[model samples]
Target chain A: MSRADTAGSGERMKVVVTRNLGPDVMPLLQERKELDLVVWPEDRPCEREWFLQNVPGATGVIVMLSDKVNQELYEAAGPTLKIVSTMSVGYEHIDLQGAAQRNIRVGYTPDVLTDAVADISIMLALMAGRNVRETTELVARGDWPNTAWAPYGFVGPQLSANWVHPTRTAGFLGFGRISKATLARLVPFGFTDCVYTSNPSSTPNPAADAETARTYGLRSVRRVGLPELAAQSDVVFVLAPGGAATHHVVDAAFLRGMKSTAVLVNTARGTLVDSDALATALRERWIWGAGVDVVEGEPHVGREHPLVREPRCVVLPHIASATIETRLGMATTAAKNLLGALFGEAMPAEVQM
Target chain B: MSRADTAGSGERMKVVVTRNLGPDVMPLLQERKELDLVVWPEDRPCEREWFLQNVPGATGVIVMLSDKVNQELYEAAGPTLKIVSTMSVGYEHIDLQGAAQRNIRVGYTPDVLTDAVADISIMLALMAGRNVRETTELVARGDWPNTAWAPYGFVGPQLSANWVHPTRTAGFLGFGRISKATLARLVPFGFTDCVYTSNPSSTPNPAADAETARTYGLRSVRRVGLPELAAQSDVVFVLAPGGAATHHVVDAAFLRGMKSTAVLVNTARGTLVDSDALATALRERWIWGAGVDVVEGEPHVGREHPLVREPRCVVLPHIASATIETRLGMATTAAKNLLGALFGEAMPAEVQM
Candidate 1:
């Protein structure tokens, strides 16, 4: 009944798009004559009820990270849904087990955003390391007229290696695609050593690490424990996944172990780091500074948030992959995945379950 | 008489230091029995009257950029000033022509702070291109609570080359040591092409450009005219030397030639870019955005400044070389240069007249 109300023709397959994919990508869906598209006209998140009501009788659904694919939604769709394409690299919102049992293909954008995440990770590192938060605020406060340049004024640790620092090390909490891309970025900044802590359950391969070292032309690329990662790194990048197992991995003890001159950058999940511990560390000068793109309870992170109140802490609203090119690539990929699954073709970047 | 009043001994040479060289370097001047050092006690700039009164019988003086070396100062030094060691790379404050005419050896810190400048240059580029000013303030203003994620919310241009964009080009107004260091930093970002504009009076060495490309692993590094540079580059870095010859090199016409997606970064000097023109360009979207560490009539740039008021412009307080390591290196260089000049060894980084 909902499908009949939304779709122009009952003969054509129904495809529900949660948001406009923009002119560059919407054309891909609009050009198709064999399908009827039911796109959400609003810019904000499609209301849950609206999404559920519209998803019914849809053969394919294009969703965002906010959209969750569950058994209830599947049941509501009445076995017509062949695919659930999400325009994000993350798939935590989608229930893979339920989708697999229901014989549905799950499509997600992955490699297209690797560069964006890596670029912003390095950006946060540089911003935090160089005191961008305090310095920029000073400019905004009209303090330039009174703040004369001093020898050591607003000084922070240099991110690049010079003659004095012939070798620099970069640490990663997770050495996956995003982390490796970040490592690639550090090489040009003259990073000599690369240490990372990966999934504890995964098998360690020194040979793979050696090959990585060879590829990046680094002195060594090895998998180290979390403590070693905190202690040895000049700049630590938190790029691990979000979950119970990785919750508060960067806690008080870990923060205490970091070098006073070192900078901490997190473009990963905020659950991987404890905000209170980080605030205390910054207040005590345990670490030089921190730049984080995500928080434990983000979207609710306010001016009164502990990390936001810290002068040395730079907080961003979870926008690690917020670049036009990356978003377009994701939208295009999502559209293609939707079209592919609707016509029974292999979907690009489909989650294997 | 002023020197005798300040110094304890008549036999020793008086060395006037305008500011504390910090703990690591002050001992270098303090330990020497042959010199009588009159160091300023305050953290702020040394009063001009105090400097003039103290330099009367001094053999050497270590000055900052705020202290100018001129004819009147030379006349007041009573012909005993052997060297003017400045703890900065730029010698614009020093009257080089006057120093050369008087045969006073000028020592400056050079070949250091290159990495600092380059590091901050990239940092500014990333910050400006990525809507940092708008987004960071949004978080700081407690706006994150209501700003839910949208399909293309807060999207910006991608700095690094992605799968779709296989090549990226970087432009420079001046291609010198600092510019080269900045170029080295961009390689990891997947910049394949490099274009630059040098002194028009200088010879165009295609061979040297090719060698530079080879060294950086870039596809092509060539010298182009100003208009071509603005048109072709994805990012333009203003790193040329400051003075009349290069004043306001990035004016309205040059900015108009640039791509709408381009980002302009100026780490060299305030005079190299026109603040009003840049503000207008940003306001009209002539170019994506701009990041400048220096502004014209600096130490005076307030909230009402045109560039400061623009949301797209990211302004810094000329802290491009504001890193502890770089500052220490500069102080040490200045101290060593002073010691080297006083002892009559080859003064490190001396200005050749």
Candidate 2:
């Protein structure tokens, strides 16, 4: 069927947006009169039924990580769908094989989120090490006036390397773009040494590690096994991908191995850490503290959640890439990806299938 | 009185300690058999009466910022007191002139706290810019699941510069050690320009500013007036000294002049910012948000305090130096200074009047 059969002239095409893209980014799609647009009314994730019904005749669609783009959704869109654009770097929710079978291009927002996530990672490290949550809560609860100033009161391990620990070491579970960005930020904090573990399938590159160390002016940067990463690091960052293969990577055993003064930061994915085990670790002082932006089954994490209830854990709802600059960039990239794929122009960032 | 009169047959010198230094630093003072140490029993600031009563015939006193070292105390201690060592960088609470007149060497912990304060300053900047306090509070309150994930949902101005805004600017109220260290951290976040205001007594150093700009790969680092700093800065850091000269420096006019998207961080002194004006500014959206580690009349900031009640402000209980490593260094330095002054080995960090 032609565009005329749907609602307008043959030049007009239907494009469905999974959620509101806000005033800054909506105009990019709305300005194109040739495209008929449908935005889900809710500020929250769109209903699956509404998406399925609306996407049936759509030539393109924009989605978020919360929205799964799988075989059923592809079948619902039929032959009209040419592209699926997601406003996130991670495409785990999308079925790449299914999309490839349908010859549909997948566009995702990346590179733009690096700074925001990196900022959050460093913030977590500081918050965890400084005990920002507990200490701030005390002040908010009207306890500041009564609390006496003591020499060692409210003290926690410092994030920066100092003369006391002249050779402070940093560890990363996955030394990807965000982790590298975090390392760059920490260099000014007086961190001198570094260790990381990448994907098990990938080979270690000593040359690249050495170059990274020299570039950052660090004492050393080397790949390490999980135990060494846990035992030696002053601060450990979990920045690896989330999937079954990496589930519970930072479990009881891993937490047990961490130094009592070390801090753990997870700005990547929740599934990589075991929430219950981490809570226990914090309770037992197996590790000093944790700062996590994501938790297992997030958006459903209540006050009763293990990590949420952990006094030493700084749990934030998933907002690692929640900066105005980043979200706008993601939305614009998503819109541009859809517009480009629809018009036969090359996508600015297409995910390889 | 001679050493024999002060203690047991010249075997020990009388020393008054205002509070118990923790395990990591206690040994530095305790290991000296030549010192007869009298530690204030409570884990709080030693009362003035108790301190006065115990300081008599003491050769040295180790104190915190909360302790007042006035002329009366100096006279009360008589000619025996040789040193007043404070475990803080700030010495406003101490009577420096009185100490000098009494021939009492003043030692303070500086340099050691620079990294900790600088770390907190950046943490506040990021927290304010990203709305971490409000967003995380929502999550902690179990309201996150209901909150929508709109593209602009928890979005705030990014701390880093990007293609859209290639020149991000950072402003400092004081260009001191902490401010420079904070600037170092911001450079990695993509801040390209900096403006700061130093003490009026300080001579303008164009060469140093130029060198700093080049070292950080920044576009410029010029000393600017309050109005220009307020208007041009994307993030204004109130890091000036806390006294009459700098009190209420970030007042209503300054807040009003700031960009609505800008963030204000105060990790130095709370008096530098007008709490009521800042609260009103945040309430009225005159500015984006603020993160304050220090508040005016602190240790007394209750829930009813305007800054504490402001939703956009993230308040901490004056914990910029609340890091284990920094605090330990401070305690050790204070102890060493006392030991040095008492033994006539030249105080390592003597505060010259």
Each candidate's interface RMSD, rounded to one decimal?
A: 0.9, 1.1
Looking at model 2, residue B58 earns an lDDT score of 88
Residue-by-residue lDDT tens digits, candidate 2, A1-353: 34233433366788999988888889999987778899999767899999998999788999998898998999999998889999999899999999998899999998989988999999999999898999888988999999887777888998887768877899999999899999998998888999999898999999999999999999899999999999999899999989998899999999999999999999888899998999999999999999999988877888888888887899888888988788889999999999888776678899987
lDDT of 1 at A36: 84
| Candidate 1 residue runs with Cα over 4 Å from true position | A1-10, B1-10
List residue ranges in candidate 2 displaced over 4 A.
A1-11, B1-11
Q: What is the TM-score of chain B in candidate 1?
A: 0.96
Tens-place lDDT per residue, model 2, B1-353, is 25243332455788999989888888987887788899999877799999999999888899999989998899889898888999999999899888878888899998999989999999998899888888878877988667656677788888887656878999999988889999998888888899998888889999999999999889999998999999999999888888899989999999999999999999888788889999999999999999998888988999999988987899999889988888888998999899887765656688978
Most accurate candidate by TM-score: 1
Candidate number of the best lDDT: 1
Ten-residue region with minimum lDDT total, candidate 1 chain B: B1-10
Per-residue CA lDDT of model 1 for A1-353, tens digit only, reads: 34333434447888999999898999998887777899999989888889889988888899998887787889888778888999988788898898898889999998898999999999899888888899999999999999978899999998999666788999999998999999998998889999999898999999999999999999999899989998999999998889899999999999999989899999988888999999999999999999999999888999999999998998889888889999999999999998777765568889878
